[model samples]
Target: MKENIDLFTNLLEKKYGVWNRNKALFGTTPYGKVASDLSISSSQFSKLLYGTATEGMYERTLNNINRLIERQSIEKAYEETQLVINKSKTAYRKRIYFFSILFLGIGLITSYLFDFNHFAFKLSDYEKHPLKSYFYPESSMFFDSPFIYNNAISENCPCSGFEGKWKLSESFKLPLPGMKKPGLYYQAKSADMIIRCSNLFDSYIDKGHGMMGYEHLKSEIWIDTKQEPLVPQYFNPSSKVFTESFKQLNFESDPRFKKIADLAAFNVNMFKIHGDSITRNAELTGRLAIDVNKKLAKKYNIDIGYIVKNVLGDLIKASCKTTFNPFCNPNDLSEGISKISFDCVYTINEENLGLNEGYPYTKSYLFKDQVFSDYLPCECEDN
Candidate 1:
């Protein structure tokens, strides 16, 4: 643990350079911002550095630090590899140009001597191999350069800025507890847009579908930020963002929607506390559980307790897939859980919330429901 802590400190120094506590609190420093991203407090981060933190905190912090280290290593390696490839490509182009001129001169001499002008001059008419296949191909060949073969990325790549904005649907406050000043802010947005657009561009440029010209493919290159913001439905409490996204459609009238949003906010507030906070979550869940039940019960004027219980129960079961136990003990939220306990639960809760608002189950659509279906794909999968 001490070794890992030292490594983490070294990494911080190398990545962010040295920070001065006299100038700023550790929590307010760029180095401290990393801890904030992991939902660790300044004191806890201090404890982590000094090897005085709990075993769980140590392990979690070490894992995140290791992740940071690994990511940086990969990025550095990629930049180096690209540099080499670019150099090789320049050399290769020069060689190809020299050889092409030599071949053309030889052909012209042979044509003049043998009266084969028809064949030699007609070299310009030789059909060119498709650019996609000649340069970058779906599958690599023996003579292909490292650049061509390396086109496929093992992990998702970020999209170019020209594509459009991919924003998070929900915004959250930082998880730092008891700070005198306002804490950092965060949001949950899609991180895989780059890879998605890359694949799309490959399809377009490669003429994967045999499209004729750029006019037909112009619209496909850009994503409409207003119509489709590419916000994912997953929950990530530690994420911090400096920018804001544009407005999106909201179904604030729905009780379930409000409940899910509130629960998400509550979970973000409770992230990394790992103690009595579970009780607070339980209390919040209890209220939400009752609120949702009451709305359903009053709307249908029938006994919906059993249905609501089963639905939330199923949600809890699904959310606990990574845990030792399959359910959150109402009496003790901290009993057996790992990671953010209530994130996935509320993320999916809004899907069933539409029932309270008089729509069929989320998968299906009713008349004039295209608006909901179009705007919110999470609740309506068919859209």
Candidate 2:
């Protein structure tokens, strides 16, 4: 039991990252710090510091110390093990749920398009055969040969190095059309996609090789394109309170940080506005579909000229309007505005519009018709 207590005490010191010392002889500095922090007395600390062999003292103090250490170790181990188990279980459940939903969605789509007899025949044939059924009518297109739909799928090509797919390759040659020069271009894909590397000895170091290696390749196209600022409004910097707040944030926070918090809040508001606009447009489009009258147009503010003028972009002209009917059809609404860029109209001035001193102007754009219709009640009016 004496040997066991000594071994246990040694183990406790080693496990807890603490020092092993004689309780009575040790200076008050270390023992006093521990006792003060732990709310234990000198004698109590001494028992843990140098365990005893007597049954009563050993059971009461020494055993309790061992039990406490053991409990901590066990609890830590249990938490770590439980975390791993929970993560694995969650992943397994997600995979099962995903595949089940995918299969179910495919089944529903198949059932909707094909008759029962054809569907059952195809299913049975598919179950029995692999390669032959792979090229079947309905299943062949998206499920069997997804590459047909997604043409970008190719052999382990050079582009993968830049895009982060291939890691072993030292460098990649971009196949830019009509480029006089071709070589590895080191840049980040976007501002949001910068790579960071820390000391290899650090626990937080992520050393996985691949796109992670080429994460430094950032995209600065927005800088050159000179795209209209998303939020061009100037925020009013006139208020003493606001100026102080701005100073506090700018000085204390990270230097690289942009004033994105306000931009994010503005974006959220824009999204809400856009969502409301879409709902109103859908209602207007439905009304137009049934009756294309002047009253309906007036009520919904459906200016045919505006729609025609808005859809004049090169991409929009090439895609939706060219192939689809009614040049500006209602059914083609989904595909038409999928990629339209709406210029944001509002501005935030940190200072009074007249005083441009401390106030910085932010430029923003919203997709036209994406925000609440021009007819909706203005929230600013309420204010």
Candidate 3:
């Protein structure tokens, strides 16, 4: 695929000079003009160059691209191709859904369209507002340093040379297209700060994997800044109160961490109680011509659950990051602070466990068995 891409691009460049995506778009300087031809702003366009773009593309659109480019690479042909590219980019831009920023009116970045759907707060004003930065990047900065990480995920951390930044390539579940990175290891300090800080990390409990049942599968803890003093009175869970009470998260307090522990305990109990039901009803509401025997599928699914649970338990060796966004956000989430989210699958050796291979095999088989989707296969076979 990359070869074909290079070939097509080389052909265009041969006809025209080095093809400038920015010049072809708005016919202006490279700085802001890159975003003008399409819905992706200048920053996003740059990130695309940075190889941090998402892997969402349409085959129809890709096919249409061939017809749109200049055949001869002549000046007039280039103009025509440019117009076609502009239209194509704009068409693709409409499909994405960005998370909304908290301060909508405050213009933070270069383009309005790019920053429109981001969850951003002023780096300076963050003490006043709370953010769930663990799930997604903030509008301005990421909390780093003095992070209290569970011992399960923080062994021999930061690896070797990767100290300056927390979010490194080593932690990525799936590496992005750009440069390779070394992981940054964060350590928690017993300092003047409290459990929660003026710095905030996002809190979102993602539901179970396909047919895995609805429970929080991931628990992420992103460092914000120096912790604020722990205040027990602010235990309320409102949005505004979320900000004020953010300081209540205490690292030393065993009871304080119980909220997270409860989530873990709940997941374990659900697995025990509904283990059969989850595997049994993986494919639900599908009417079949004949009754499909799900005994084997149920067995495979149960085995797969163990694989996942064990893998989740193996966070000790994997990089302690929850998500991997290499470059800064369109709205600049880093606020100049190096950002990295810390998380763990917990207690397993990656070399010993072929969970890498086991994961894909288990996940795929379940889907084929209709364990993750709404459709049911008519025939069930023994593998």
**Judged by TM-score, which candidate is best?**
1
**RMSD of each predicted structure:** 23.5, 29.0, 26.1
Which candidate gets the maximum lDDT versus the true structure?
A: 1
Model 2: residues >4 Å from true position, as ranges? 1-8, 18-40, 47-55, 86-383
Report lDDT per candidate: 0.31, 0.27, 0.25
| TM-score for each predicted model, relative to the true structure | 0.25, 0.19, 0.16
TM-score of 1: 0.25
Extract clashing residue pairs from model 1.
158-194, 159-194
TM-score, ranked from best to worst: 1, 2, 3
The sequence of per-residue lDDT tens digits that candidate 2 reaches over residues 24-72 is 2223336665455444476766665555334444433432343344446
lDDT of 1 by residue, 206-300 (tens): 21111111000000001111222122222122342112322232223322221211111111011111112211111112212212224423433
Q: Give the Cα error of residue 219 in candidate 2, in Å.
A: 69
Which of 1 and 3 is the better model by TM-score? 1
